[model samples]
Target: MAEITASAVKELRERSGAGMMDCKKALTETGGDLEAASDWLRSKGLAAAAKKSSRTAAEGLVGVAVAGTKGVAIEVNSQTDFVAKNEIFQGFVREVTGIALEKGDDIDALKASPMAQGGTVEEVLTANIATIGENQVLRRAKAVSVSQGAVIPYVHNAAAPGLGKIGVLVALESDAGVDVLEPLGKQIAMHVAAAFPLALDENGLDQDTLERERAIATEKAAESGKPADIIAKMVEGTVRKFAKENSLLNQLFVMDGKTPVSEVVAKAAKDAGATIKLTDYVRFQLGEGIEKEESDFAAEVAATAGLTK
Candidate 1:
């Protein structure tokens, strides 16, 4: 038995595209031979995962789990929508979402975390890929917690209890009880799902996004054929309106369509006789940013059949 170093395992992993643990095992089994280890992984069908990795995995579930005041939302993506309905895939998402609640939002940390099932999350994910014959990715995870009030979760278009197309977690920090916070948090979470606010507040909005908006505003204001100072004021107003519409706290409540989210929460707190602050939130819409590849099935099948015209 040869000593299998970390470098050896890493080289084998890169060559075979298998999980770290699987690579290490392959190296140990092949007496630290990288080529043989790659062969071993290929024989096990684990290396096939690499071939499928290029496929866009933008169709899966956004899973949410809440434990007490803490809540987590995770997006686990699959190559096809049919696989999203698979129990194995859904079970993996549920288990991983639970692990994410404990592991926090760092994707690397979540992947490396040990699962109650027999292996680390990444290892299990690799095995799942081989078993399911589809590319699956643990895209992102976000966790939000409140020190006192409640972190409420809501799933829109739910495929299961906590699994869905959209998962939202709203953290309400307050001295109020769950009874007061739960309803308010839920409504806000639903609003987040529907409105897709870019940030919690104006300050939280992305600088680049603001700059882009400003540039667009500046261009459009200039097109008005007005004076320089007037154009500047116009640009300012346009940017301000953009920020207000996109920021969660400033955005009008979806429920009422008139009251801002900040006001809605404040009114809820007032009605409940408590100081409730909407602190943080996470909205994981499944495959929100991934660019999915489109292919014609007839053309693909014809190509596969070697019947090119």
Candidate 2:
């Protein structure tokens, strides 16, 4: 049997959000194997799941750029928010977004592409890390374009002309004039950023998510004790409502809260004297789905300064 130290127990407790004694017990049960202990706790339902959320991802910046009908958005992460404020790091993110628009959103291709300063993107990033003194990573990138319409870009909490903490690209495919559609597209993009719609439409929602909603609806309808036909109608209604609420175009306009987004697009088309269609949209929020590491600063300081129990 492996000895379980206090620090090991504390680390496990912090990672699993379990009590200190439970963490110690888990460690002891698994012979001091951290991964095995995590799984063991999960099997016994003592921990929620076997997920290890120790990666710190609190520092990152969102970048966006638009060129004619094409637009690109990216999120670059750093070890600290202080690095995000570095002028060199910010400039790298901005220029890389422009390159992403031209070279496509593939991270490998972007890294290989020539930077504006006469070196590969990767080379520039490396040089920036040396100068800025922090580890940085190109997390993700996305591009949107329209043949006949505009791809409006929006950056929330902007750090520069085309960089921020949240970036969105709304693609409107239409023959409509910019004067009539730009504002509308921007409004819709803002709504998307705020609402974080699951998918573009009913068909785009995940199969498991759809099944889960259907199961919930079926259970609720079955509780009514109605006839089979009535229960079926109730379930259908529930599913349809779920889709409309979760879908981007089918959702009601957040600005007016009355008009459906599809109808809003239609009205814009009429006003512009041209047909309009919302093809797609992309919204990127910093550190989404990245469970950051938790730290007890007071304990860390006390231990580091040799003042701990």
Best by TM-score: 1
Kindly report which residue stretches of model 2 are placed more than 4 angstroms away from their true locations once superposed: 1-55, 216-235, 299-309
**Candidate 1 backbone collisions, by pair:** none
RMSD of 1: 2.3
List pairs with backbone clashes in candidate 2: none
The whole-model lDDT of each prediction reads 0.91, 0.82
On residues 1-309, what C-alpha lDDT tens digit does candidate 2 reach at each position? 899999998888777765466688889999999999887766654454222122354576989888888888888887677877888888889889888988899998998899878978876765555466555678889898989889998888887788887899999988877887789889998899888888998899898988898899999999999998999899889888998899998998989898988899998888778989998888999888766667898998999799998
Error of 2 at 162 (Å): 1.3
lDDT of 2 at 276: 91
